[model samples]
Target: MLGFIDSADSHLMSTRSCGACSLHSSHRHALEEIRKVPISKRQILCLIALAYGNFCVAACVSLQAPFFPAECDNKGVSSQVYGLIFGIYELVILTASPIFGKMFAYVSPNFFLESGLFLAGITTVLFGILDRIADSLQFTVLAFSLRIFEGAGAAAFLTSCYTIMPLEFPDHISFLFALLETFFGLGLIVGPTVGGALFEVGGYITPFAVLGTCMILGSLVSIILLPKSGGVTQSKSPSVFAFLCDIGTLLDVLTIAGCLNLIGFNAATLEHHLRQFNLSPTKIGSIFIITGSVYALTNPLWGKLGEYKFDARWMSILGTAINIVGLLFMGPADFLPIEPQLWLVIVSLIIVGIGMAAKQVSAYIACLNDTINRRGYPNETSTYALVSATNFSSCSAGAFLGPSVGGYLLGTIGYRASTQVILGFEILTLILLVLYKLCGS
Candidate 1:
């Protein structure tokens, strides 16, 4: 279990321990001092900006869900092509995150945060007008290009925000992280509803145009309210490769990827599945809300558990188990001898949402703690940036893989069999996690 750290060069470990001891002492002192004071006005303003940013980015990501596939179908594009377009955003994010992570020391987080919001907002507005291109090929190309740029902007925004949070509130890292995620969850909850309603009112362009303008305005406000420093101090940071080399850390990262894969799978295919109900866009969007609502409500509980020093591995294991059960019912499996029902889908989504929140929160905390504690990485902005990049990249990878794979499978084998394939992947992840725990003992 500790083999990765144990196998490192003894000399290097001794050097790292000395450096880390001093860093940890200083870090702890700073946090203790911060706790003694009331939350500063600056911190409050920063939190508001960060929370709003999270909300906007998430809303943009999910906003397309209710209408995108049908719109693509109308344009003569196939499910496979549209799925790849969706996956491409995460692909870009995965590629861009490590590059931004390495630059954290040289650049101010405020620059990344504000610029990212602006870029994403602009691209979103551009995307709104893509329907004007009547040619199928042109529409596809523009869609892909805009999504790619938007993904890069999202990557920068997320990475910088992650780094900023730990620096600003080291004492409440997990809680604050969870709190921001709650806002993200809220964005997910709201995106489809608003998008569906706006799409009904003004067709394809309205949701993007309206939401994109809000993001642009939000960026301008963030520039004014966010602190100039971003709490970054120049320091040597460990490479992203260093974190990947550790077995424990790698496992936690894999857990994040697997969990997100399930999410991406649903995002890509669930709208199609619900077509059988012949629901309106607004109702379809409301169905999408079930999972996000559960996730938003449950995230704080998981974060509080992490803040109180609960065993994260156990939380992960339990979450995985719950997720598997949800998936089993989600498909009603080929073996269950039951037909799909609206109530069943809702129940399964609620369960999956709870499980996802638990896994996500615990995995992040586990990765961060394992790096700083067991691996002896320093508690500083550089380390925070690297960790943020690694985890977000994992999520991007899963998000990319899930839709690309799920779409192909959905087109080829249909929804029921496709869900079973996802179930198999989750089972594999569960087995690996259990084996790791048992072997470590």
Candidate 2:
């Protein structure tokens, strides 16, 4: 997987006479590189199948946010218990993703991909079944177990997808990563909308049933359509321990992950805060759509930018700065002296989305570049696996922490103050970025 880095070829921004011309030239160069890579018809089919599978996996990850709380209340579940049920999925992912990532060293990627989908499908069905059971310790335990099971599946599916892309499209790593994330973002955008609509029409069970069936179909596609294996050798793989302990790389993970935590922090509270205005569910949901749409739409653009114009570190830092401005505008809309317009919130969310897309894509590229530089090649499975796992793990940690921390602050001090938590985190990240840049210079 290790390819020689051509310094002139790798730095896309240096290729042209002017800024706009540079962007266009780099884009054309990217297209030309992609065109040079000859992917077989079967490879195309498999990539599509994997993409679809990732979509379903992402949808399942988010489907419960809208309906689960109401259902838990109806079943007499406590707020703490409900929150636990909600967070446990990510908690499981945080712990399990690394293990699954490492397993790719010994197991076939196809095996993990197919088996994970099947397990996720089964667990989704089980989660729906929990809806029928009387609320009790048994019910709560079963629910937690099912969510953990699904999380394991999610971890496996994502690890496999992330690993496959770099291996399969080694020449177009940034573009392919961006493309895959676009699908993932699309699923997240649609999941709540579709799940809520299904819940309204067919009750609590329908969304999981429909989405779970999709997973089963994805599993079949993985088994039948995708290749069985493109084996990565293990003899020269990096120690997972060493990779985790490296301070420089670990700092990158912390910086990106910490910024992501703030994004999650604001997002987790968006619907709740919007409802303070007595807005209709449809109106509130539309706000989410705007944010998600922006994230989905700009993901590929950011990917292209990282691949062409600048080093991903610069992108990540700039992304963090932009996100801070957006986050400041987001919450305590009620606290503003003027009556808050919906337009303001919408614009803020869009900005947030753009910043998130930049950070997430660039961070991944930065990590991959760092890994390649350290290892003298990009083909090291354990190195990629560890990096990928750390990415997912940190994101999951943020997802879990965001709601808990944000909700706690909201309850204790009120909405305006709750946002300060996010502000503090982002400010800290900005300072770190500046310090790192100065020190590197």
Candidate 3:
């Protein structure tokens, strides 16, 4: 069992990206708590459960572009009504994450995770049914109600993944997050491909139903694997920051958090731009394929790089730059003569793909190490949760803004102008980094 506990500590759900910085006193206390508990199968179950739930979330997300409009039209809804729907969903996630984070320290993570998966599947199933009912433009009420449950379930599953992975394997925390993040990326890539195929064969109903089924299966796997996680210590909130004894951990985590948000902004805007180009479902799917291939192929390399050789900050920065360039190219891809612009867009996406892979892995690795060094969290699991959620909070926020602005820019000036806006955000992010360094030093 300990051998399943990889010489690498992090699991399919962890995300630390650093090493050997020194554990904080609080981390020492957490590790001590873990040592006192004997390992059991329950801990593994917890991890499997969360991973399955996250996979479900990704499945639904991957199919959105294909299904959402059709689902809405099945009810006589107009295209004019789409923006608020997406916005409301984003709003729910953005508002719900921190609350869920705070809740993780108090509630049973397993219970929270299970309840979330249960609701996510249930509400999604309902979303399918609701689409069939389509009466009037109570769109806000109809759309947001489902989004509330989706957001709640999503936040819960995410928080639990981080919380459980570390406790499941305490000493080898870094590699643990590496595996977790890698699988997470892999799932995100595949979910869409599957969803796209379902869209062609079965339309909107298929993705929703398949997603629900996936959640159900995930629920069962979780029940079996979670018992292995019985070794977990109760979630604790230590005062490493209040005492300021964990600067490296804190800074590294925050820096990565910012970069993660930027990735979301870039990706979200890029997607909307792709749509503006009137790309076919097959073409869009192909782009996802390209992005996923790049991500999946490179993830192992990034992990290997981080093991002993990679400079995480450099990785994060370079990732951000590549994403910016990709986004900028997308603008021209939209309008320019169609031949070179298309190739340019594809190539630019490749760059974005590489950056996203490198950025997330390195940042996560760095965060894991900081948590371990500063707090001595044998798993650095909880800190990973907080940091990841913080990053995603930025992610959800940027995604929300990205679409609205991207849409407006596309409508008013076009994809080229919108791409410029995305570039501006990247520059601003770089400026933010400089400011952070000045303050930190």
Candidate 4:
């Protein structure tokens, strides 16, 4: 009895000696961390700036989408030039992503991010002024050139912001990432809506000018408050080239998300599908509302899950499964052997949105975890740069490819058949993911 009491006293004296207590303490610490929110004014300012920057980047990407063709027509340029202008923007972003990522070795991410914002602002101003040019060839040339520059700026901005995120909010990295994505998604939708309104109010120049001013203002705020350096020191950073050469480390799931985005966007347009139903324009628009709302609502939830060390692979698998089910149900809602209800279309899209959120959030967290845990880097700017670059490039490529390929398939093979093509691609992605999981385990 004396010996047992002595042992209990010793255990009480040294908490670490009690394995169960140690575990409970560790778990308590983790829970405390998860519950803790950012409290610093600097953190709040930085997050606001980052979120706004994401919004601006997405907005800029889509702003010209609606008005470019009309503007080209006004300048007497061929409609083909319109596509070139948009294509050039995305192409430049794709190529510059890695280049800017490499630059982080020599320069601070803040410099790249701020400079990119400035560049985007200046290019937007140039776009507004280019409308004054009366000559078609000159107008086309200058506009395309400006857009290319804007793309470079966008690449720098995106890379820097994402790289800085984990650094700034190390404790809540996944949550922050989700928030950034949410703002970006909103920006994509808002840009065109606001741009159209501005066009109606004051034509092409007005939207550009208004948005440019806002960007410049945001840049100034960032310059004042943004960190002068990236999250990790350059001295501790790995060589970008070395990282890229290690192709095994690259997140293949990102490429899948990119492909999914392509299919998802094409599905969102739903012009041909809706035509089959003979729905009114209002009804067609409501279909988009359903999908978009679900996507936006669930983004933050996925982000929180990622932050909590949720198994991204499992999340992705679940997401992909849901996506496949959605795609299968989208086929011939009216003409199928057993006529599918219109509500199935809505149900499938909601499931697809949830799946997309899971895949996107989980894939990002997986890559981030791989970099931090597997590679064991102290400062992860280069790794994050590559991650951000891969994401931007893949999504951009998918956006460009989805419409082009999906359109061709739809035109040639019809809606039901084109869906099969998309389904096949998704299935391929799922198979690869499963293999990846097996290898990882």
lDDT of 2 by residue, 131-194 (tens): 7888577777888799889888877787677667656666665445545655676677677778
Candidate 1 C-alpha RMSD relative to the actual structure: 6.2
True-vs-predicted CA distance for residue 114, candidate 2, Å: 1.3
TM-score of each: 0.84, 0.79, 0.72, 0.66
Top-down TM-score ranking: 1, 2, 3, 4
Candidate 3 clash figure, as a count:
47
Mind giving the per-residue lDDT tens digits that candidate 1 earns over 296-344?
Answer: 6786677566556567777888888889899988867877888988789
Off by over 4 Å in 3: 1-48, 69-84, 87-94, 97-107, 130-136, 171-176, 220-225, 228-280, 303-311, 333-340, 362-389, 431-441
For residues 299-333, could you state the per-residue lDDT of candidate 3 as single tens digits?
A: 56765666657666556666667777776675564
Q: Alpha carbon lDDT of residue 30, candidate 2?
A: 57
Q: Report the Cα lDDT for residue 52, model 2.
A: 91
Off by over 4 Å in 2: 1-30, 76-81, 129-139, 164-175, 230-232, 239-250, 266-268, 278-283, 300-314, 333-342, 365-389, 410-415
RMSD of each: 6.2, 5.9, 6.7, 10.6
Give the C-alpha miss distance for residue 287 in model 2, angstroms.
2.8
Query: Top lDDT: which candidate number?
Result: 1
Best by TM-score: 1
Model 2 scores worst on lDDT over the 10 consecutive residues at 1-10
Per-residue alpha-carbon lDDT of candidate 4 for residues 1-441, written as tens digits (9 for 90 to 100): 000001111111112223334211222243344477644778888998888888887676656544554566678865345545655665676678767776787778898899898899889867888778999989988988998898888888887886787677666554455467667767666666677567767877987888877777778888988866643344444665565454334544343444345443443235456555765433543564454457667755765565565676777776777777777777643235645457877787787777766766566555545555666653333444455444445566655555445645555566676776777777877777788788864
